[model samples]
Structures are given as structure tokens and as C-alpha cells.
Target: MIKIADITNIEERKAIENIIRNYREDSGTVISLLQDIQGHYNYLPAYILQLLSRELKIPLSKIYSVATFYAQFSFNEKGKHIITVCDGTACHVKGGPLLYDYLINQLGIHGGETTPDKIFSIEIVRCLGCCAISPVMIVDDELYGNLNMQKISKILSKIRKEEMIQEGSK
Candidate 1:
């Protein structure tokens, strides 16, 4: 329901124009252009995609296909904090499922869901490339290994407190 004019400011429109101009009808540059757009906005806003389609003279469906095909691209807005739980073979063997379940219970959101307040989002990834520290979960860039329910509780509490303090400061 968001309009292009509502979601895009003058500065963002100029940036998008620059990105399209730089690549200009080079279909090979589609991925790179989308990446740049995603960098500007946390996710690919529908309006931006529509604008990109018109600017590049590419089919909107084609652009959408590319966006949806990639796991790295997100269509919906992400939360302020992203929490990823490793569900790879090594992590699962090391009780990754248990950790995931614990998080779901604590946050009241399953993997791939964001909290109602938009404070946190959880994802279950195959691996975080740190199997050495199996059963690992990451909050934003910080990693926690050898996790248990107790550890998860403490981590969530700490993050909540930090969010509260940040809100108070604002």
C-alpha cells in the first residue's frame, strides 16, 4: 500500500537514478543494481522495484523473479536486530534445534518471523560458517556459541534492556 512518492525521498530518488544511470539497460548488471538498492533500503521496497523497472525498461515481473529467487534478498522490512540460528548439520548435532525452539518460545516468534514491535527478527540459516562453534546463534554481528536455554534467556534480556535504554535516550 506504500506509494513510491511516500517511500522515496528526493535524496533516495537521486541515488536510485544514479544507480540506474550507471548501469543503464545492461541486464547483466541487474543483480548489482538490486544490491545497491538493497543497501540503500534495508529491503527491496516495492515502489523502488517499480521505479527500477521503469528506469531500466525491464519487465517488473523479471525484476521480481530475480529478487524472490535469491535468499539474500528480502522483500519485507527487517527488524532493527537480526538473530540467526545455525541449523546446519554440525549445529543440529550440537543441539541447534533445541536452541532454535528455545528462542521461538522466548520471543514468541518462529524462525523467519519478526516480532510485532519490529525490535527483533529471527532466521534459521544452514550455517554461519562457524561450525567449530556449533549450536551457535548470532545477534546482528555478535556470535554466541555453546548456547543453552539459560544463555539464550540472558542474551535476550540484555538485548531488550539495551533497546529500552536506546529508546529512552531518543
Candidate 2:
């Protein structure tokens, strides 16, 4: 476990301190502070949270409660790409489950799991407000609807090719 005192990244510590200072006066800014921290680190680092608790003089329990209560806040690191499958009533009736299974099988990851390479993370959401486009899967911000196995394969292939090209360029 990383302790607050052991946070050696001077710039990161400064950034956290700055965030705390910026929101210190506003008692209701806890959520916004946490959101900024999460945006910086992708997930809340335990050491940073400890630092925040000390700097802001807020109880760790309260901070933790707020973090866990919000579905958007995540403790675990996420993959570079987030794939959300809609499992709403409309989507489910239109073969959302099948698409989810196909994704799991193809990616070799269960729901709520990131691929080993960190290329993709699979998640299921209740709704995406696109009932007309039921059975939808969103990769990053791009949405795919009316999908079949072949369309899924093509999409995956295209993404993989793009990634490979990007990696090669890098």
C-alpha cells in the first residue's frame, strides 16, 4: 500500500495540492475535486485520496462514500478503450445479450473486464437512450447499431488495424 507521505511524484503532489486549494473554500466542491483527480489519474489513487483527506480535513470515510456512491467514479484502472453494450429492455429483446456474448468470446474477457493488452474494456449499461438503434455497442465514443456477428468482426478488425498502424507509427 502506498502511503500519502510516500508519494514521490512532486508534480503530481503539487497538482493534487492545487486542486485542494482551488476547492478548499467551497464545502460542496468535494465531488468536483474528486472528479478532477479522477480525470487526472483515470482512477483515484489511494495515496492521493489520503493526501486530499489530510489537506481538505474531510474524513476519508465521507470521501470514500461519495466516490463509491457515484457510478462514474472507478477505483480500478480502465483500458484505453471502453466498450459499453446496452442491455436495456429494448436492446435485450433485440439480441443485446448475444452481441455481448460474442464480444466476450472474441475479446476473451468477461463483462466488466479489460483485455490483457488494455486495448478494450467491456461494460454493460442499462440504457443509452437509443431505443431505435437497439442492440447497440459503443466502443469509445463510436456507436454501432443493428449489429450482427459479421459486423462485429469487421468493426474489431478495423479497430485492430488502426491500432496497429498507430503503434507502428509511434
Candidate 3:
């Protein structure tokens, strides 16, 4: 286990310390602590998890057992934008796989992976709960349904153009 002193980033150390202090060793608060960590950092970082294991006297395996049980938590760092493709029975019947293939080809990253540039990542989900809008794709919070490759391309292009403009300004 890496010691607290081994963490090089001053801010990260402080954040972990704050988490430990806030949660203490309360057994029931483990999930809450993990949630707090994920909420603050966007994901459970490996170093932070290790520190948590030692301080809480919980085996790393136990911690992982709990974390993996929930889909809400992610171990990998995510991109700025999350693209969710629905592959549920309804969506699948309506060409969801075709949409997914287009996304992997266009974004150059498989589902559950971020693009090399960290601008986009794809997440494949069983359903988004709106069966009426079958074959759905969601970009961040915006929902698009009844999509074809053409519409998907236009949407992706618009987002890329917006990003390029933002990058130029910076």
C-alpha cells in the first residue's frame, strides 16, 4: 500500500485527507465515502482507493467488491462528454447496434473507452427508459432519437466544431 506521504500531488493528498476526516471509520459510511470520492474526482482513482483501504482498515478487495456492485461508479477517468447508446431490446430492434458501430468507427474508441484526445467517451447501456424513442443516443444530457448515421454525423460534427472554436479562443 502506498503511504499518504507517497502521493505527490498536494491537492490530491488534501482531498483524500478531507475524505478520511469526513467519513472516519464508520462502517456504514463506506459507500458514502466512495460516493463522495467519486463525486468530487469524477471517478475512484486507484491511489485514493488504496489510501482509503489502509486508513479504513478494509481490505482493498472488499472495497472493490462494494464499488463494482454499483454501476454508478467508474474506475476509469472519463472524457468531458459522455455518449450513452441504448442497446435494450427496443433500441436493438430499432438499429441500436448500427448506431453503436457508427459511434465506435467515428469516435475511434470502443464502448466504455474515451477517445485518445479525451474529448469524447462512449458508454453502452441496456436502456434509457424511453422505449418510444427507440434507437436513442444521448450526448451529455441531450437526447436524440430515431437516429441514422447522417444525423449522428451532423450532431458529432457540430460538437467538434464547437470544441474547435472553444480551443481557438483558449
Which candidate achieves the best TM-score against the true structure? 2
- Put down candidate 3 lDDT per residue, 33-90, tens digits, no spaces: 8898887777888978988898878899988988999988999988778899888999
lDDT of 1: 0.83
Which lDDT value does model 3 have at 80?
Answer: 74
lDDT string, candidate 2, 14-103, tens digits: 777668777865654778988999878777877778777876778999899999999999887777778888889999999888888898
Q: Name the best candidate (by lDDT).
A: 3
**How would the candidate models be sorted by lDDT, starting from the highest?**
3, 1, 2
Between candidates 1 and 2, the one scoring higher on TM-score is 2
RMSD of each: 3.4, 2.9, 2.9
Worst 10 residues of 2 by lDDT: 1-10
Off by over 4 Å in 2: 1-5, 8-18, 24-28, 165-170
Give the clashing pairs for model 2: none
List the candidates ranked by TM-score, beginning with the highest: 2, 3, 1
lDDT (0 to 1) per candidate:
0.83, 0.83, 0.87
Assess candidate 2 and give its lDDT: 0.83
